[model samples]
Target: MKKILRRLRRFIRRLLGIKPRMVWLTHPVFLQHEPGGSHPDSPERIRAVEAELKAQNIWRHLQTAEAGEVSDTQLALVHSRRYLHFLEANQPPEGKIYRIDDDTVMSHDSMTAARFAAGAVVAAVDMVMAKKAHNAFCAARPPGHHAKSGSAGGFCLINSTAVGAMYAIAEYRLQRIAVIDFDVHHGDGTTEIFKDDPRILFLNVFEADLFPFPDLEKERGSSPNMLHTPFERGASSLTFRRRIRNEWLPVLGSFKPELILFSAGFDAHRDDETGRLNLHEADFSWLTHKIVQTASSCNGRIVSVLEGGYTLTPLGKSAAAHIRVLAGKGRGVDVMRYNRRLKQRT
Candidate 1:
């Protein structure tokens, strides 16, 4: 009955000239990657985003799809085979967790979840490039920006966005691609992988003196392809927006990329303590609109993969705001008021 109703809904939308604008991809495995012991990157992050979208009545309007299965060949495009072998060979025993580093841990199901996370981005790229949807959002985690080609860190196991970018270049033969990351922490791993590659233009906007790259200040201008823009702690929305317009937009416009990919991380939200930045949902919505506007030149192709947002409430609210814009639904939720209501409930 549910399947029939879904089909009927699709038909009715088509008849009414309501074309679906985006696809949302996720997987069940993402929920099982428990890192244990007070980890902020919990499965509840995904749940929070899901619950918020449903509450906002946005879920019903999206075209939900399962994550694609990424194979060894595709993963090797960005990662080494030996490192891949090590991950599979080193799966912890049942009920035991393996620590990759001080910040990264892997339960038995971690690799499986990581694979699917990368797969979700790959699938999104395919969907957007094929014009099946104007854009796509993959809600899979453990986040991947801090992950290197050979080593995992910052609770990341695979560099999913890098994998997806490489996949697009290989499969579709795209000469120029833009990878834009707005996470609070520098996308050091991604920068390392693509620093020498002229085909990729990496625009990274991150906070200065953060984890994994306290020395990032000295490393600026080392690579021509990778442009690093650092923001001081507690940067205001105006500063961020102005810098993006004055600094990043010109480079993006000049490149005229064939495909655009985003490493979307909401940890920089004002309410999320981890990021310590004063960005609200409105800021995120504004950025999404800018990205959509840029996509106008490239057949409106975009694939956004989730990165970091620890606080459940703001994470959900911010993610929903971004997705709603991507889905071509003008914003309706007042994030400040919604947060106040939740506090009242509590």
Candidate 2:
């Protein structure tokens, strides 16, 4: 009787110990909506990262979610109704491209995929807030940071991260949200949407003189809260760390945000063709550690959304490192083996 009772307690404890990490994965069908020839924002990028994660055996640990389409009502929380209607009504014909701007384009499937991309972030916020998982990572494309409330630019159709932040505020009643965008390119659309809002803190670090030119400085929003750092081309990991230490860390520590969101972009990788920032895979690992460290004050709440990473090797490496840190698997600790060799290395 005593042994059975002990066994039962052990089983219950094991079940309770399961800490699932949530990750939203967009379908490869999202690739079918390509707008132009041989673009860097291809479906192959996500596929490659997925394959690498699977190879590392970390894929099984993630709670996978198929992102659905976000309704106009939900999108309207951030975007104007008129713009939403225009996007829904102007469905581009198959094999034909409809240009929203000089750089943004739409295809027959672009709208549908964009809706899913935005919806992924919204769903991730819900999952984290509901305690379904400790945190989440949205793996979607047609990246959101470039899309404004009224218009799309820089290959983006909908501002997914902004929409997600709005949903957290309006639906989840979450106060004091923080958005940290580390994409190589500036998140102009996200900045534009929340520039005036004080409840949200938008911190962006991007390469200076990059696309969507004219970077952000200490511009006071309506609520008067924003931070923008522009780094020169070929900036090293040390410089990256210094800027985060000097600029972002203090602000975040002061804010003590309830929820943290990361616009994770790997274009800063040295191998990426789109940007010239010289960040290696280890830099992403270090940054992830810092973000997680910041989130610890808020009980370790974080949601990271994939934005851009053009190259295969660096994107996969950086993403794996980021996920590893988020999962608490890369803290110089090995869980699979309790051997002397691994223990000594750590």
Candidate 3:
């Protein structure tokens, strides 16, 4: 009876031409990306996010889809054949853990998780391009913004948003696409890959002196498609919003990208221990509103893939704010509660 009612509701919505949907992509394989104990980035992050969204009943607003693995062709969109070969060669055997760096570690299943994480974003691009859903978010891991073309670090193994943007450009023939990285860390990997490609606008805001930090500032390429806004540690919400408004909004206004892909990382939240700069759920809500508004003006298409939120409590709260906003749900307690929390923390 419940299933019948759901089907009937879908039919009615279709009949009414109310086909708005915020598709969320996740996969069980994402849970297999355990880096080790005491690591900030763990499988528990996904669990916490899933539990909160379910408890809040936000899933009702989302068109949840099981994410798939990225095809080799899709990986080829961003990663090189040699790099793919290197990652495959270094993948750990069953029940074994291999450490890539002081912070990055991979178990046997980590490769699968990384591939699917990137694939989830690629699939979200397909869904948006096909109008299967208005916008989509991939709640997968390990996070990808920190992963470079030939290397992975900062708990990231694959550059998902970068790959998805490339897929949209190559497959869907999208002329201009913007990748907005609000992960509290610079997306050096993404900038590295798409430095010279004018087809992409890689705009970001990150806390200064963070991990996987890029030595250079912005893209030094031919067409100039990248912008970086760095914040000092302990920067308040006012500073955060002000800089983005000044730096990103104008660039995005002019870029008029056909699609927007977000490297949505909530690690900047005040409660998160991984980073020093403080942000809150309300900030995330406002940020989503800005991005949604921008996308709406150009083309109502966005694909947000998970990147770097670690602290479970704040991660869940902030991600809920982001996803709910994407689902067209108004910001709830996040508007005031998290703002107060942010003030307290900072």
In Å, residue 33's CA in model 1 sits off its true spot by 0.2
Off by over 4 Å in 3: 1-16, 216-223, 336-346
The TM-score of candidate 3 is: 0.91
Q: Could you tell me the lDDT of residue 130 within candidate 1?
A: 70
Evaluate all candidate structures by whole-model CA lDDT and list the values in order: 0.86, 0.80, 0.84
Tens digits of lDDT, candidate 3, 1-346: 7547756766787889988598878899988877778888888888888788887788778877778899999898788889888788989888889888898898899989989998899889888887778899898999888778887778888899988988888888888998999998888888778887889888878887887665543333333788878888999888898888887888898888899999999999999888888777889998989877865654679899988888899999889988888888888764767667666876
Return the lDDT, model 1, position 276: 78
Q: Compared to the true structure, candidate 1 yields what TM-score?
A: 0.91
For model 1, state the Cα shift of residue 212 in Å: 1.1
Give the Cα error of residue 26 in candidate 1, in Å. Answer: 0.5
Number of residue pairs clashing in candidate 3, backbone atoms closer than 3 angstroms, sequence gap of 3 or more or interchain? 0
Alpha-carbon shift of residue 8 in model 2 (angstroms) = 20
Q: Write the per-residue lDDT of candidate 2 for residues 252-321, one digit (tens) a residue.
A: 8888888888899998989988999988777777788887787566576788888989888888877887
